[model samples]
Target: MVYIRRSNTRVVTERNLDFKEEFQKKLSIIEDGLKTYLPHEDEKPEIIHQAMRYSVSSGGKRIRPILAMATYEMFDRDVKYILPVACAIEYIHTYSLIHDDLPAMDNDDFRRGKPTSHRVFGEAIAILAGDALLTHAFNVIYESALTYSERMKLYVLAGKEIAEACDSKGLVGGQVIDINSVSIIDTSEKLMDMDIRKTGCLIRASVVAGAIIGGAGSSDILYLNTFGEKLGLAFQVQDDILDYKENEIFPDKPTYTSILGIEGAREYVKKLSKDAIDSLNIFGDKAAFLRNLTMSLIDRKA
Candidate 1:
């Protein structure tokens, strides 16, 4: 759905022709980029390549990369420059999912309606697939940076952002905390911290890396960073709420709804969602597509 801002009021509009067309066009570009960046399944070490393709090509909303593209577009229309990095972000996200579903992790049998990587390729292959994607993500960024020799520093900074997000103090750290927790997360501070590190870091990397490549100034970068953090947390909270609504919440796991209760969780989502949208004011009408995308995400059923 599209979100239009009228002076002093923000209105929600159904996803109409204009918004759909624009969003679809961008999505098409991102899909094509992912295909081009990924290795061919027939390449050497075909098993690992096949597993990577299988996991990444599985049906899912390509939100992270799309966020990067949209954020980049806010400053520069030439999205080609950012496409590689955007796809790399997806590769990293896909890698995380592969690992998350491993036998040692969540041990799920399916992902995005398809058999999980381990289920399809066996555990060893699945682990290697995740490892390959994680390492390849950096190579994609590096190759893209080489192509854009003049903007090497910007690319370096973008790569660093993604790297740190997935590193020990970020996504991995959060995962460790999640798997190691001996008791239910009873405090808002601890849960928020874990959620931000685990889920929000990569999202923050997506927006910040896009802005960096787009040559945004410090203030703009700060605003987009804030936007990403708030949006990421809101996204997770909403997911918790949905699980609760669907009777899928695990008693052993602590979610936003678990800690805050349903009504309180809903209220938190509203606050975070509003803050996320408000952070885009600096981009003015140029951010309409992003604003609408943000609204749609918060209200998504799945």
Candidate 2:
């Protein structure tokens, strides 16, 4: 087994940073960080701040940040140093969801069981809120401190990874294909490509960024990169399964279930999930949370 050097040792205080509790602990930290960094409700231009806050505060799993911290923790890096970067990921994710739900986009009326940002704040406010959240993510990352000297370079590298993921050929590109692929995606490979870009890109960035912050070696970095991509794809497949069960309004959209059937998609999820777990084998027991996370993500209900 290849050993990773220059990584943080696990904090002595937390002996059991594994299982369900670890997941909740990381999620709670991310949730609080998100709330703390969001613009105040009474800040200048109250309406915009309110809209942005509303969007960020809306309930969700906060998985992106969790992924970042979990990866960072696996390398024994102090999670505090990476919190802002992790939070930045959530901001970007929230922005995407808000914009995706707008009238010109997915046109959804609800998110996390509440009215969507646009539905409550109007289309213009929702658009601005998404824009603000996206900008805020980068701004926070740029302004936040990196504890290590090499972290500056790592920051730039990881930031570029995230930016590229958000670019036209990644997140937006995936969404564009989502809109256009109903007729184009006849094969499982083609559909998986679209899913990877839209969902897997950001997820990959989350873990990749964490590894960078933790000073992981090239081999470990490569393993985590593959893990993130496989996990991200599994995540999207799980979402497709959920949508198949909970909603059917978008029958026109291409999904794994649409092409592979529910049983087939479930089997696909198991395959991707196993690949993700295998990716962590290089890390040994240090990756318990991440390995379990892969299973939890697959079994998620909401």
Candidate 3:
């Protein structure tokens, strides 16, 4: 006998939305929740908390958190229930950015076009603030799992993916390779492997965690992960393409554009974005926002 594959995803509503309008609405909600969830600047150990807030409140697109929420909302409309977990994604992303911009890492002087955390807060406080955000992410996940979830397994699954996404072999490992690559020659495979871990892991985790937490069945989880993976790779490739368009290079380390050339890189991004959108076809029209989001990710400027 033969069997046909199917999507186990569900829909909470059928209202059509202008993609930009929906994105802004969801982004606003995420921003408000993130502010309320973070430590107050005037709290004890004020400078650390201030640094945390400064980075957290910076002009980010809130894409990761919104991706989580959007994926979750596909199966259920309980945004309140998932708000904390979603915030955890933002915290995790922010922590990565803070540390990535430290004097020892990317050694950047800015983030979101503003002074980097280390530039304003000093290195010691910057490091500590990153630590604080990193530690707090787990707490938010654990608390949200216990407090708002009917099925602890859902949050457990989400937490597991989020944690693994930050593992030495995942996000951190990618960063390590990047920093160490200045003197090393790289192949296309090596570059892709590193980028997938460094930049793609969290983006993949965002959607996978969201889809699983949103009540997708086992098959749906697999397909959604595929969607996340494709979308994530496309995002990185597009970033490289954008950089190449400006300066024809990414400073150091290898980029997809460096390996594939400009047109090849654009083709690569286009194919991945199409594949990502096609992955959503399994869920029918319920995944409209996700499809729109995947396409938009490649074209974003900041």
Off by over 4 Å in 1: 5-15, 182-184, 245-250
Ranking by TM-score: 1, 3, 2
TM-score of 1: 0.94
| Highest TM-score scorer | 1
Which residue window of length 10 is worst by lDDT in model 3?
Answer: 1-10
Better of 1 and 3 by TM-score: 1
240: Cα error in model 1, Å:
0.3
lDDT (Cα, tens digit) per residue for candidate 2, span 1-302:
11223244553224334366777888888888888888899999999999988988888888889999988887765777788889999999989899889877789999778999988989998899999999999887876645454467877777888889999999989888877787788778998889889899999999999887777888999999999999999999999898895444436777788778889999999899989989989888888778777877898887
| TM per candidate | 0.94, 0.90, 0.91
Best by lDDT: 1
Q: Candidate 2 clash total?
A: 1
Q: Of models 1 and 3, which has the larger lDDT?
A: 1
- Model 1 poorest 10 in a row by lDDT: 5-14
Model 1: lDDT equals 0.88
Q: Tell me the lDDT of model 1 at 51.
A: 94
lDDT per residue (tens digit) for residues 1-302 in model 1: 55553443333334445666788897899889888998999998899999999988895788899899889988888988999999999999999999999879888998888899999999999999999999999999999889999989999999999999999999999888888653846777788888898899999899999999999999999999999999989989989888885443436768887778888899999999999999999888888887888888888999
